[model samples]
Target: MNVLVIGASRGIGLELVRQYLDAGQRVIATARDADGLARLKDVGAQTIQLDVADPASVSGLSWLLDGEKLDLALYVAGVFSTGGAISPPTQQDFDVMMHTNVLGVMQALPQVAPWVEEAGGQFAFLSSDMGHIGDSRSSRGWLYKVSKAALNMAVVAAQPDYPRAQFLLLHPGWVQTDMGTSAAALTVQDSVSALRQTLAKHKSSKTIHGCDDVPYLQWDGRPFAGW
Candidate 1:
């Protein structure tokens, strides 16, 4: 299958590229920098330069992949801010997180959605459980939480526009990555293994449910009740 992995510079994104290639899939990996692109190329992935926050870059990506059809278009780009209090976040923090986590998806969805739809494939975003409004009980990573929440809604909002493609919001289960930290609950391998299995199951099923029914899912492909 042909797959596209956005924000594949490091961490979970990079690992996904590696594992997909190992599975003998044709993988296209995108990153914002030359170094990241080079690293992805070393792993046998076709690399593209894309900055989700930049409209020009996003538009260019559409032109670049115009004729190519993707079986899976996975967006793994996101940012996390440290401070988490009742107080509002600083303008810079808010902008960075929103731009990377929210607007980034907004900008890329339009371009990638058609590709996935044309191929009768799936579009998955790497979302977090922290974004679950019904599950919130503490105040931590407030900025990141807000951004991811917005991302979840954005995915739902876009679903109707691309009925042929299945849109999914996935939580990677706090894997050991830069964002998840060394003390995270699961390793990158564990998370990616489950993720691949989930993707395979979804592909085999060929059924797309309503947004409310399957909005958010765990890494293992089970529906997340809290969402």
Candidate 2:
């Protein structure tokens, strides 16, 4: 299988690339840093340097992979702001997060969606538990939270547009990623394993139930035992 992983330079994105490649998949890992892409190249995965915040880059991604076939496309590129959601919110940080987390996904969809649809593949995106507004317990990282929440809805909205493809709005949990900090519950390996399980159990099937639970997460999606 061929996979395209965005934001493969660091954190959970990086680990996902590693795990996929180890599973003998042909991986094309893209990041904003040239050096980061180069490192993944040494690991038997092809690399592309892309800035999802740039429309030109998103358009160019299609051309880079035109000659190849893709089986999985995972979008995990995001930016984090220091402002704890409410106080001292910086305009620059908000713009950055919105571009990377929100608009970027919107722009990327038009390009990657057709390719996956033509190939009969899977589409997975990284959402967060924080994105769950219905289950909001508190608020600190407001910008990040809102952007990811928007992204989740974006994926949900796109499902109908690409009926043959499985669109995953996955929550990797509080993983110990660079953005996640060391105090997180699960390691990249553990969180990704759950994500993988969820992906497999829900892959390429359409019942409006392409959701996950870590086989153990509490209060995942809405409703119970029905699609």
Candidate 3:
């Protein structure tokens, strides 16, 4: 399969690239710092340079992949910032998060979405339980939760418009990575394993579930409010 992974330089993204490459799939991995992703190149993954926050960069990638057929496009690029009841997000932090998590979706549609549409491939936005209003556990990381929540809704809204393609919003759980931290419940490998298993079960049906998390303490972003 022709697989494209954005943000493949570190953590879960890096692991995803490794797994796909080991599966003998043609994998194209992207990172803002191409040098950082050199390990992917060493592992036989074709590395592409990408900055999800930049429209120009997204457009450049779109042009590069326009002629190619892509079977899977996974948006794994994300950012996190600390926020608490007393300390809300700065305008810059909010903009950066939304730019990558939300605007990146908008940017990617013109590029990879068409390939998925034509090939009937699968598309997924890495989502978080922080967006789940159904859960009552609150989180203090406003930037991460809100961006993920917006991404989930974006996936829900866009799934239908693409023909033959299945759009999924997945919660990878609290993984032990720079973002998830050592206190997180799952290792990056374990989390990716579960996430891959969940993704492998996709059908044309319209529904969503990837072990939901309780609503936690989020800052002012209202990451838990899904409506």
Candidate 4:
């Protein structure tokens, strides 16, 4: 199987690359910096230097991936903002969060979705349950929530254009990553393992959970209600 992990410098993305390589699948992973590229290379993944937040950088992705039919393509690049509605986000914070969480996904969709479609694969974007408006509880990271909400809409809207590929908006749960913090519930390994399993299930299913389209799902393969 051929897998492409975008933004694989560290955290969940890096772990995904490691796990897939361990499973003996051919992996191509991307990182924004030299250090990140080195780490991915050390893990035995074919590496690409990429910064999803930059339009010019993302524009060349298709060229790099030419002639490859990806079995799984994951858009895991994201940034978090801690400001609530009352605290109002700064311009820099807003740009960083929105660009990484929403705009970056939009930019890469056109480039990578077709590759996944070619192999009847799964295209997943890492989203958060905090983005679910109906399930909203706290406004701890209101800016991030808004950005992810937009991310959900972007991926779900693009699904119709790539009907052969199963597009999934996934919440990896509260993971123990840089963004999720050490106090989070699930470890990175557990979260990513479950996410891989969920992607496998979606890829093999004709209709997920009896639904014709599965727009949003948890890492454990459960669908999100009112998302």
Best by lDDT: 4
**What does the lDDT read for residue 7 in candidate 2?**
81
Q: Count the backbone clashes (under 3 Å) in each candidate.
A: 0, 3, 11, 0
lDDT of each residue in 38-155, candidate 2, tens digit only: 7788777788889999888888877777766567898989877545745766788878889999999998886787777767778888776667777666667778889977987677
**For candidate 3, which ten residues in a row score worst on lDDT?**
212-221
Give me the runs in candidate 1 sitting further than 4 Å from their true place. 204-209, 213-215
Off by over 4 Å in 3: 205-227
Per-residue error (Å), model 1, residue 108: 0.2
Query: Model 2 — TM-score against the truth?
Result: 0.87
lDDT of each: 0.88, 0.75, 0.73, 0.89
How does residue 122 of candidate 3 score in lDDT? 75
Q: What is the lDDT of residue 133 in candidate 4?
A: 92
> Which is the winner by lDDT between candidate 2 and candidate 3?
2
What TM-score goes with each of the models? Answer: 0.95, 0.87, 0.85, 0.95
lDDT at 30, model 2: 88
| Residue 202, model 4: Cα distance from true site in angstroms | 1.8
117-164 in candidate 3: lDDT tens per residue?
666677777767766656636567767777777777666666556646
